[model samples]
Structure formats: structure tokens, C-alpha cells
Target: MEVFSEYLIFSARYDVSMVTELDDSKPEIKAVTLDLWETLLLERDGANEQRNLIRCRNLARALSKFGVKISVDRLISVLKAMTPWLLTVWEKNREVTHLDQIRFIIKAATDGSVSLREEWLDELSSAYVSAIYELPPYLNPDAPQLLRWLKDHGKKIGLICNVGRTPGFILRRFLKDEGIGNFFDVMIFSDEAGIRKPHPEIFRMAARRLGVKPSEIIHVGDNLRSDVWGAKNAGFKAIHFSTRKGRDTIAESDPNSLISISRKLGGLKEEEIIPDRTITSLAMAIEGIEELER
Candidate 1:
């Protein structure tokens, strides 16, 4: 096993070939923990772009009602500058609430010279949430099947998601709308939990809520550092759902985002982030879990 500051990666050899059946006799895992974005849900093509435009427009409109008068371009730029700070908070495994985000933007818009009323902040947050609601991301096609399979097989399922800008309350509503909310026995969102992944606390909390030991829970997620390293550190088995086929593609598409997030969060090497198993799609999760037990 390759050990990093916060986690250990077990080196194992197994056939990566697809398995078509689950060995009903080998049901050792008591629970399963899943990541939210990219694992069970994916934004529709160009959905992110559309959401950003809507967010900017709504935010600008909200500020206008407060007589703040910030242009959409300026709002976007202020938000972009706040990304690093947002990352910094996340790196600490801490969550920045939606209200706090709006406060920061308002501060930036006014060059640190203005303070908005509490009612105004609430208005901005609601507007932002409304925009997000208008363009909710759809779930991956295979997600419902996988989630149902696990639940029907008597495994306690939980969701561990990192949130920024959007709160956990909103996400729960989205899950219900998509018809998978009932599958999760427990849902832990960073904003609600006050800690984000790569943090052992978050993983441990999920295990606690599910009434299972960390060793008896398998965490499946797409991000190497956040999901794999975090779960491993908490003594849980992990499966990496490489949605883009491989790490190379992920790095190429968003070179700085994940790497920088990992670095700021501390204690993960590329090698240490390796998972016990890798699945290219969510449909493979069932077999992957069974294989791990074997």
C-alpha cells in the first residue's frame, strides 16, 4: 500500500474485465457511500455554461433591486476572483454557505465600501438558488439502476457530496425530483456538515450515520483525492469512477482545478490517490463492489 499523509492506497491485482453477475453468497459489505457530482449526476452538455449565464443575470438583477448597480460582466469578474478564496475555504475542509458567497460578491461589487441589509443578502441568495433551480443538472443514466441495485440488495446507501454555492437543502429537493432521494439512507453535504471531502471527518460521519464501521462501507466517487483518499484514510474501501475514461482526460480538461484543490486540502500524491478499483461507468459499480469483497 502506498501511504500518504492522510490516506493509504492498497495495491491489488485483479482482472479489470467486466463481471456480469454478483455472487449472492459474498455479501460482506453492509453499506455503500457515493459521491454526488460526476458519479451519480452529470451536468447536461453545455448546462454549466447556461447556468453560469443565468446566475450572473439573476445576481445582477438582485443587486440592481438593492440599488447596487453592478453589471453582469463585473459580477462575473468578482466571482472569478472569489474562486481562489472559495477554494481556500474548501481546502480547509470547511464549507462556505450560499449567504456567505453572496456577501463576498456584494463586498467586491462595492469595493469594500458598502454593506447590504440582511434582507438584501437573503434576496440575493434566493435569486441565485432560483437560477440554479431553473437549470438543474440531470442524473447519469446508470445512477438510478446502480442505486436501486444496492438498496434492494440490503445495503445501506449514503450520499457524501461537496457543495459550493448550492446548499444541501436544494440538492435534496433535486434528488427527490429525479426520483432517487429515497435510495439514500443518509445524505451528507459539505455545506450542511461543515466539512468537505479529503477530510476523514466527513467520511467518518457518513459511516456513523449509516450505523456501519468504515471498513464495511465502500465509497464510490470520481475525484481521486477527495473520494478515494478521503475514504481510504477513514478505513473504507474505495472505487474510482473515472467518468472521463481516465485521469489523463480529467487533468487535460481541468488542469488546475482538481490538482489545486488537492494541494490546498493537503496530503495527497497522485500515486496515493489510486483506488482499490476503477470503474469507467456507474453501471460497473455493483460488480466492482462484489469484486472488492472477493
Candidate 2:
């Protein structure tokens, strides 16, 4: 959690034939690297976001058709009430569960904000508005600043996303929506690769496409094995994005315990602690890399 500056020596030795490419004309993309999900597109960790709020709103709207006539303001109140329970659900499954049923139950629960029917309401609408809005480190919003900064230093950027079930389609949609699709030279997704991180092949695939030896590229991500060790072992510069949440409590605890907990949770690793560079915010990441070069 403590972002420390440590010098590291990286190994670079890649066998080329083992790497296959779909196209050789993509400028050997100067930097073929990335770890998607939390690294680039950050959805709200808890329930407080535009999409789920709207999801609740849409559910309420649909229930109106069923003669339940719930006002959006009242639905907003319901969403506010649901926010506390939202964390419980996230901590439980890391994904929203039974959304329609939950909202309908919320409308009906005496403990819920609006007490309507207790037993059963008709089926809620199938309008899932989960991916409505996206947060920052967006490809477009600050691109002129970020791209100008990254471009000035002659670093090419690409994505190396490790998705569990979400495919490249979702990733592309998010990027395209943000209007920053032009930034990445290549986009790699776990679903597309049929292999997940801690596996060397995926990294190899990225390096191959970039036409640069892995050693020349630096991979930035939130995960340790997928982003750090995987790239480190594959001979690329590995940088870890240690978040404040992971470190805030540790700021008070003994550093050893912090390191231990981080390791256990896959956030901290022995080699990871000593990244060639460490960054807390992507906005500052390019600056950090410049500082490292200095």
C-alpha cells in the first residue's frame, strides 16, 4: 500500500517463433500492454452509481405498467434505502444479484422504503441498465492531456485485459463509448485468449503483437499475478497500482502486517513490492514513469 521507489533489473529473452500474429502491419505497436477492468474502467465498488440507480428506476417504471404506479422520486428513495444493503451484496458475491426481485421486495418490504405488496408483485421489467455510465482514466476525456503526455515520451499504449466472463465486446463498447478507442494499438481479452493470467502465453502474445521485446514494455494493472508477476516473468516492466483502500488501514498498522495481508489477498507480492515504478493514480502514472526514467 505504501508506494515506494525501488530499482529493479528485468530479464528480457523471448523466442519469436512461439509468438503468432494476426497482422504484422500494426506498427509492431510500440507498446502492446494493458490489464483491463479495474485498471481502466472503474465501476462503482458499492451500489452508488448511475446505472444501478437507473436500473432501479427502470424497474419501478416497468412496475408502473403492472398497475403498481411507483414514482421515480419514490424509486429514488427506494434506491437510497437499498444502498446500505448494496455493500452486503457486493461483499457477498462481487456482483449484483436478483436485481428485479430485490427491488420489488424492497418496494414491498415493510422495512423497505416504500411498503407496497408484501408477498409477491408481478415480474419486474427486463431493463438492465448496469453499464450505463463509466468513470475516469477514460480514453477520451483527458486524452489530449494524457495522450500528449504519453506521446511526447514516445510510449504506445494497448490493452491486456483479463476478463472472467465479460468479453472483448464489452471492453470495446466501453472504450468506444468513451471515444478513446484509438489510443490502444491492440486489445487483448482473457475470454478471447481462452487463457487467464499467471499464464505466460498471454503476455507473450501481447509482446509479439507490439513487435517489441517484452522487456521494453511496462504493464500497469491492479492485480499482482495477472499484471505484475505475469509480465515480470515474461520479461516486461511490471508496475502495480496499489490502491489507497488497500493501504489506508495499513497506514496505521505495522508495515509488516500490511505487507502480509496484501500478499495473502493477492495484492502484495515479494517481487511486486519492488516494482520498477509504483503508481496510485493513472493520471500520475505517466509522470511517475518519467520520474523513473530520470
Candidate 3:
């Protein structure tokens, strides 16, 4: 989750907003850009769970190539940081999975008493095993309700992720496992692209795949730099999903101040006919877009 706070400002804003619940009555998005990390599912802080888990898995796989052996506990430690957030995955599975179970798995895997087959040990050297075992899980169950809403509303959706180490394959697999794969018109992973957010090219690429000009699309993400700035630069409508409640107060404290803050944060200066509008929730975004047509 390195640089995650900066990456997920859009989600953070939405998290703060005490607005109408998520809805999709008059969806106008020719396409949608989703920021993977916090926007889709959040991993535990400090663990780099998603990436490290893949490294562990890959390292084990690579070691097997060299005839190295490994232990399950070691494999578990490598995968400890990864936890499945069923709520975020399944459209119908909104129930939260117990965190304790996740914790227990990690603790047990890291516990010193576990052992593995000698042949497995031979294939996986201690150095590789330790590195892999020390990695974490990609656990996040935020549910596919948002994705589902977009899909059901007849909008094309795509993923635009900014990740440090996690690969696009993992994200693809994760999304597919959550049953949201069918919703995306395209998926853009920074790792695979070699270019990250704030780069208009990435957003533009996704828009290209959807067969629409960026101007006709709406990008909903949790970042100011990558999501807001980049989307606007690419000529797409940008909406800030401020998730907080007191923002209305903040905005009201001095509408000018809010305007100033928004502009400085890569938002429109209240008077400027800018990238359409800003919203606090997916539900509001849907409504606002509809209102624009009215």
C-alpha cells in the first residue's frame, strides 16, 4: 500500500461523505475507469499483501524449476498478508468475513513450529523461502456492488490500477474470482503497462478499448493525481468521490474556501465550466449525470 493514501483520495473522499447510498438509475457513462486498490478492495496497511503474495507464489514456482523444495507453513507465511474480502468480491456476498480467521492463518503460518518435506525444502532454499514466507496476503472483500451497479446500468466499465508490485494477472484473477470480470470493458494495470497514473496515455488507452473518445467517458477513482488530473487531461469527465460527511460543512464554511481547495487539489474553480461535476457517491454520480441531461 505504498503511496496508497495519495492513490486513494477519491475513495477517501467517498468514505467521508454521508450521502445517499450507491445507486444507478440513469447511468450515462459510456465507460468507467476504476482504480483498483482502495477503490475496489483495500489490503491491510504495511504488508504489501497483494504483491508480496504473488512474489511468494512466483518464487516458489521458480524454485520448483530449480528443484528446490518448500514447506506449506512457509508458503502460508508468504500468503499470510493475502485475505479474501468476500463482501467486496461477490455481488450477493455482502457479509463480512471474520478478520480473526485471517489473523489466525497468518499467525499459524509464521509460528516457528511448522516443518515441511525435505524434498520440498531442497527445492526452496531458506533465503527464497524466508522472503516468500515473510510476504503477505491480498485479502480484501469490498464486494462487487459498485461494479454490479455499473454493469446493470448498462455502462461499460474498465479498471485503471496504480500498483507498485502487484501484477495485472493477479488483479485480473482477483476480479474474475469476485465475479466482476464481465463488467470491465478493459483492464489496465500499471505493472504491465510500465506507465502509471497521472499519465493520460493509460486512461486514454482504456478509453480507446471501449471504442469511445475520452470526452464521452466518466472516470470514478480514488486518486487526485491519477484519477482527477489524468482523466481531465485525457479529456474525460472527472468526478471526485468524496466519501466524508462533514465536507458539506467544510464546503459551507466558506464556499470560496471549498472552491479554492478543490482547485488546488486538481478540481475545478467553482466558476470555471470544468470537467462537468464532482460527487460524493456512486449513487450521486449517477443522479448528477442524469440531471445534466435534464
Every model's TM-score: 0.84, 0.52, 0.51
Alpha-carbon RMSD, each predicted model = 10.0, 13.0, 18.6
Please state the error at residue 163 of candidate 1 in Å: 0.7
Q: What tens digits encode model 2's per-residue C-alpha lDDT throughout 31-148?
A: 6365665566553333224454566676666666656665666655655555445434322323333443355445553355554343433344234333344222333233345555
Using lDDT as the measure, the top candidate is: 1
Best by TM-score: 1
Q: How many Å off is the CA of 145 in candidate 1?
A: 0.7
Pairs with backbone N, CA or C atoms under 3 Å apart (clashes), candidate 1: none
lDDT-best of 1 and 2:
1
C-alpha lDDT score of every prediction, in listed order:
0.80, 0.55, 0.55
Please list the residue runs of candidate 2 whose C-alpha ends up more than 4 Å from where it truly belongs after superposition: 1-32, 47-144, 246-273, 291-294
Question: What is the per-residue lDDT of model 3 for residues 65-132, given as tens digits with 9 covering 90 to 100?
Answer: 65544454486453543333321221121222222222333344547343334454434333232332
Model 3 has a clash total of 34
Q: How accurate is candidate 1 locally (lDDT)?
A: 0.80
